[model samples]
Structure formats: C-alpha cells, structure tokens
Target: MTAKLWIDSDVCMSSGRCVADLPRVFRFDDEEIAELVPDADIDAEFDAHRDLLVAAVRNCPAGAIHLQEDGVEVEA
Candidate 1:
C-alpha cells in the first residue's frame, strides 16, 4: 500500500532521527525542524522501505512524523 507521509514541524523537537535515518525521505529545514525531502517519491520509498519508515515513525521522539494510508493514520 502506498502511504502518505509528513512531519509536523510544530511538534518536531529537532531530534534528527528521521533526517539521519532516512535522508532520502526526510531532511532538516533551515530552522532544524524535520521536513520531507523535496521531490521524494513517497510511495516508492514506502514500498521499498516500509519497515524503516515505520521504525522511524515509532522512534520519533516528538511524535512529529506521520503516515497515512487510505486516509487513515498509520499506527507505526
């Protein structure tokens, strides 16, 4: 399943886990908040790295990472 992913910067704590762990899918903005990488093919990433993506979400200290499939929030 193709899932949509996003980071809630307001809730992000600059933990850097996602950015460090999944550079292709996430990066830190100028303000150091995590954000999705520009032009990232989230679907393909999800397809190829489902386990890693889920782990990232589960490991995010601020719970700022989010994934949704079919309009429902994924539970990591």
Candidate 2:
C-alpha cells in the first residue's frame, strides 16, 4: 500500500517547496501555506509521485509534511 500524506499546517513555514516539488498533490491554500489539495487521493498520489513527495518532505524546512499507511505513520 502507498503512504497517505498530509501536512501539518501549523508547522508549515510557507516555504512553497512542497508546491514546487509536487503540484499534483501539494498546493498553496488561501493562507499561502503548503497543503494537500482537498480532493487529492493521498495513497494514489504517493504511489505515483513517491520521489517528489520524498523530496518535498526532505525539502520542507519546517518538517511539516508526513505520511501514514494503514494508520501507521511513515517516516521517509
């Protein structure tokens, strides 16, 4: 199974790296903070763009992005 990803907005620094890294999944909300699109299929996105998502998590200065699979948090 793919890892389902999400962002912790409170921890986000509006770096935009996630947006730059994965447009299909991450986007800037009204507040300009990086967040997942409302209708995004986290599992599918993760499956397709695992590399981009990994880059996002690695590039996010605030370390706000995270993933889960089967209710267990993913760390990568």
Candidate 3:
C-alpha cells in the first residue's frame, strides 16, 4: 500500500548518491554499498518524503535503489 525504500547492495556501485541526498535514511556500510539506517522502517518514512526518496533513487548511477509494497515493486 506504500512505497518502501531499499538498496540492492550487490548492484550498488558505492556512488554515495543516496547518502548525499539523504544521510538520515542512508549510509555506507563497511563493504562500501549504500545501506539504510539501522532499525529504521522505510514505509513509515516514505509518507513524509516520497518525492525526495524517488529523486535519490533516480539519481543512483547503479540503479540499486528500489521501492516496493506488499512484496511488489512500485513505479517511482
């Protein structure tokens, strides 16, 4: 019912776009891939900043960002 953010670490190129756009919601792990903030729920945050998240995803060079709801991918 709502778009939730996630990153495919395997596909991420460590470009830091997501972290640059939204450091509060994204981080770089030890492996240098983009990762979500620990213990955070994207579905909950999506309501307030859906547009921002979409923009971040769109800017990802590696196309590693994804949005899903109910296990189905959502079109940004």
Candidate 4:
C-alpha cells in the first residue's frame, strides 16, 4: 500500500536534498525548510516511487522526513 509522508519542521536542516531530488513530492517552504508539496497526491507518489521516498527519508541529514504505512512508521 501507499505510504504517508511528512516532515518535522523543527528538525529540518534546510539541506534541500529532497526538494532537489524529488520536486514533485517535496518543496521548500517560505522559511526554506523542506515539506511535502501541498497539492501532491501522496498515495500516488508512494505507489509509483516507494524506493525514492524511502531513500529520501534515509538520506535526510536531519532525520526530519517521516513515512508511515498502516499507521506504523517506516524505518529507513
């Protein structure tokens, strides 16, 4: 199944990796912290690019990105 995604803004380091690597799923907020693109269909993205999403979560330097499936957090 598709996973749910979010970012912990407080922990975000503004590295821009996710935004640069997956613009369709992520973007920088006004303060420059990475966040999920508001209009993105997360389910569709998870279904289509699960590996990339997992990589994003794993690669986030600040460990700010999160993902869940069936309400259980997905570990990087």
Q: All candidates' TM-scores?
A: 0.93, 0.83, 0.82, 0.94
Which rank order by TM-score, best down to worst?
4, 1, 2, 3
What's the true lDDT of residue 4 in model 2?
68
Best by TM-score: 4
What lDDT would each prediction earn against the true structure? 0.90, 0.80, 0.81, 0.91
Q: Who wins the lDDT comparison? A: 4
Q: RMSD, model 3, all Cα superposed?
A: 1.9
lDDT at position 54, candidate 4: 86
- lDDT (10s digit) by residue, model 1, range 1-76: 7598988889999999998899999998899989999999999998899888989999998899999876888785
Over 1-76, each residue of candidate 3 has an lDDT whose tens digit, in order, gives: 5666788888999988789888889999988888999976677678777777878877888888987766777553
RMSDs, each prediction? Answer: 1.0, 1.7, 1.9, 0.9
The number of clashing residue pairs in each candidate reads: 0, 0, 0, 0
User: Considering lDDT, which of the candidate structures 3 and 4 is the better prediction for this target?
Assistant: 4
